[model samples]
Target chain A: MSENKTVLYSYWRSSCSWRVRVALAYKKIKYEYKAIHLLKDGGQQKTEEYSKINPMKAIPTLEIDGHIIGQSLAILEYLEETHPENPLMPNGAYERAIARQMMQIIGSDIQPLQNLKILGLVGQYSGDEAKKAEWARTIITNGFNGLEKLLEKHSGKFCVGDSVSFADLCLPAQVYNANRFNVDMTPYPNITRVNQYLLTIPEFIEALPQNQPDAEPQC
Target chain B: MSENKTVLYSYWRSSCSWRVRVALAYKKIKYEYKAIHLLKDGGQQKTEEYSKINPMKAIPTLEIDGHIIGQSLAILEYLEETHPENPLMPNGAYERAIARQMMQIIGSDIQPLQNLKILGLVGQYSGDEAKKAEWARTIITNGFNGLEKLLEKHSGKFCVGDSVSFADLCLPAQVYNANRFNVDMTPYPNITRVNQYLLTIPEFIEALPQNQPDAEPQC
Candidate 1:
């Protein structure tokens, strides 16, 4: 049988979208990349068509093997289960669980707080751009501080081990967002050290926000 | 060997913790519930001791199989992987992906926006209790609206099918929180229907916030 036709709906600067991009790249899976700009036209993700594809109106929804899936973690899990050659999860259940814990530190805890909707809400409530940015910084800083501690215990050239895993895929995008928010990296030496190392790897680099097809230079 | 002492570090009202509680119950795995009051003693989760257990200082950190898992999703995954009895994940990769997708809609997108940390921040910004609650209402309503659409396509006595899966574990807690925020649930009938049915099941009912050992009646 022929290969499955794959399509990834993504937004360049979205940490969750960037996560799936890295997972796709790491697995060496080829797909048609469609940019769904989060901005422009009042946020394309909110469109009715996109909403049908992803009920949450979120990005990095993968259309593959005759079906679609939303949620970056779900997309990543699908990729791992479908393409097992370059497994991102560790071997044992305990090892994999800890890796997922590291991922959730970012996925569940950090990025969601800085998501566009909340930031907009916070900005409206604060009535100040600077205060909104501070809110993002605080969220990212708290998460990175905690993640740094976990990395100190788990790192071996990567978040979980020397071999790059799913947790590794989650890190660089978060570090990028952390940098965007000016979250001080000095407090997170291990996180900084690991993110720096991951940047040298092509699979991770290619999935970066700046490298996406619709990427624009940040002001 | 003897059953591993599974201690679940949880708080009564935390959505993430409640998710794990249901998963443990659905799997019929017995565990010691260690309540860490989120608001007591300067937020017990922030203590140095607790930070060592979960750097993110988040609840539903399951201590099992001689290791600790810091995220509810991770804990749920570990339970599924280890026990494999009355499995919480559906069979088939595509089916499983959507199940996880449903879980993430609540786990990653919905509840995180209404978390205590973000709520406190919003409260600080708004300088009023009513506005903070309003902010939560907006977030939950938006998420439940999206989730309700998804439920229309996937629901069959449980999220993703007739069987109780990981996604089912995330819903009741979220609906409980939605009720707490007075989020108008009339718009999402499917979610309301599924939640009502889930509450009838003992596993879900037993894990409800009001049923928890530390539950306190609302004014």
Candidate 2:
């Protein structure tokens, strides 16, 4: 496995890509970064060459040890299984299910409703920038509201428990997204507290969108 | 584990819930079903009592062995982990990643955008029932398009390979969703093939929404 090269196809600000970046850094797995600009030249991810490796034409596709895997949560599961050192999953099955449940709170509910393509469609459908922003804000705020309630029973130093799990991988990136959309974070103290603490971790810090090679100067 | 009593909080028409039903049937796990009608009395899932058990107020929340698991994909993973009798996951790590990848295509990308809440919002905003239908159709079509392409390299007798995996659990329910929105399935031959084959299986037939106790007579 050491002889195999790991290559990640990523975009700078894609939250899904950020999740994978954090996991790779946490597990101390070395991978070559291949930037796939989501908005450049009508989106490089949509090109035939990139689509060959990732049929979904989405970022954070990992080509590791000759297997090309799309979907960020799936990538997180793969990394946890392959590199158990500095484990991102909790010890037991129930705990691991909780981790997956928390991550899906963002992955399935929040982020999917506010991704670039969906936002673009919203803007196009409404023909109003304010409406688009409102759409994203509402989606994020609603999702975080539910997340805050769930975290009441599960929160410790991190999302599922004291130690960082794959659930933590989704938090900071989503908070960043919430900030981008001007979501009021005051209501979600649990998410805010966990996200703020996560931002200080080196793995998450290095994986921040602003630190990516393709990050814009303003970002 | 045999002493455990499993319970599922579900709505008959939820595509996500239907996925769990198929998996439970395939694995031969016995569970008590408690119906949570999504549209009756302004959606029972939104009630304060239900919210305590499932903060997100979404159906297909699995209560098994004293742990309450939310999120459909997480429930599927928990089922596969707990009931290894008839395995729903593949053998190798790469194959399992492929299984998760395929499910995420539907779970994260497709279904999230077209759920009852989103469609209700679309109908409310646009003030057009047809527009809401269009929204669901477009999302499902785009997702199925990508899924169809990915299935090109992965399909044998099932979504990931010859054997049934978690990926197969998502197919029939989604195909049902697509038809409800009147999506033309002719373009997705791979998906059409796999879905039709899956329909003939006994577990899937028994898990059909029409077979559920709470199924609407029209459905």
Candidate 3:
């Protein structure tokens, strides 16, 4: 399980993929980035080759120690556990749960609702771009509403207390997606403040979608 | 921080709530079950009082030690950590990650897509019962396809190993959901085998939605 031999199957715009990227950067773990272009050629992720690597047909599958793993949260937990040098979670059990609570709010609640396939399904059903965007906005707004309240109780410089935890790893990515969908951030002052602070962190900045090798230029 | 004094805000049919219910039973943690009727009066989860307990307006909110926590996975992690007597996660980093991988596959991938709000959105857009069911079946099939592959490599008596782990905690609830959506389980032999085995377990059987105090007989 050598860190140097790691290879990450990632796509630039994938918020889930962005999560593992940030964690790897924060831990200063070197790995090969195999860009799986999600939009090109009807999604490279859907290719038979990539499917063998990740049966879920999702982005951000990490390969380490001859073992391939999927699910961004699972991969993040693995990294945190195996490489405990720069911790991404808080120390205590209760505090760690709080961190995970925030992560799940974004990861499970918000991101899944606005995922590429889901949005596509929305568009297919409604045949309206506005409706699809509205769907994304509604889920994001609901999730952010809860996140704002959580941050009020748990934030200092990050999503949970003074340290940068797993919650912080998920926040910026989801917030970035929220902006992409034009979900108003002004309603979430605490979330906005923490996201603003997170953007200044070197690890967070390095893992931004724009900073990735496969980032497409905004037209 | 006493286990006996806990209160779980749950809904009978909610798969997420079922995850926690089974965990509580497995750990022998005595807790009060506060049924929040999700469908009654336009969802009690959306009520102002319930929102105070969980700002996300979601279920399986566990209250203990003056702290209210939402997100089923986080709650399960908390129970595993705070009460390590009946451990849900296996020992060691790699093994734990595998447990989490299975949990996330079901928790994030399958369950969220088939959640009540998502199906509601599908119905609202398409106005087709078949489309709604198809949407659910599609996601469940995709998730189960991956899960079956995972189980083949990582199953013994449960989803991860010989002993029940966090992965097992997530499986039965998700399998029950898959059954509810009419997803054919025959194709995934591994998932069916595990799900069948899980149904025989006391904890899983006790946490079945039909066994809950708030259970309503099928019309």
Q: Tell me the whole-model lDDT of each prediction, alpha carbons only.
A: 0.86, 0.88, 0.87
Q: A1-219, model 2: which lDDT tens digit per residue?
A: 233888888888899999999999998988888899888899999999888877878888998977889999999999888888999887889888888888998999999999999888776666565677888888898888888987878889898788898889999889988988888888899998998899989999999988888889873
* Regions of model 1 farther than 4 Å from truth: A1-3, B1-3
lDDT of 1 by residue, A1-219 (tens): 124789999988988988899888888888898999898999999999899899888887889888888999999999899899988888988889888988888998888888887788887888886787899898898888888888899898989878777788888888887777887888888998999999999988899888989999989
Evaluate candidate 2 and give its CAPRI docking class based on DockQ.
medium
Residue-level error in angstroms, candidate 1, position B214: 2.6
Residue pairs with backbone atoms closer than 3 Å in model 1 (clashes): none
Candidate 3: share of reference interface contacts reproduced: 0.77
DockQ of 1: 0.82
Model 3 accuracy (lDDT, Cα)? 0.87
lDDT of 2 at A180: 85
| Candidate 1 CAPRI assessment class | high
Query: DockQ numbers for every candidate?
Result: 0.82, 0.73, 0.78
Docking class of 3: medium
Lowest-lDDT window of 10 residues in candidate 3 chain B? Answer: B1-10
Q: Which one wins by DockQ: 1 or 3?
A: 1
Candidate number with the higher TM-score (2 or 3) = 2
- Please provide TM-scores, in order, for all candidate models, with all chains considered together: 0.96, 0.97, 0.96
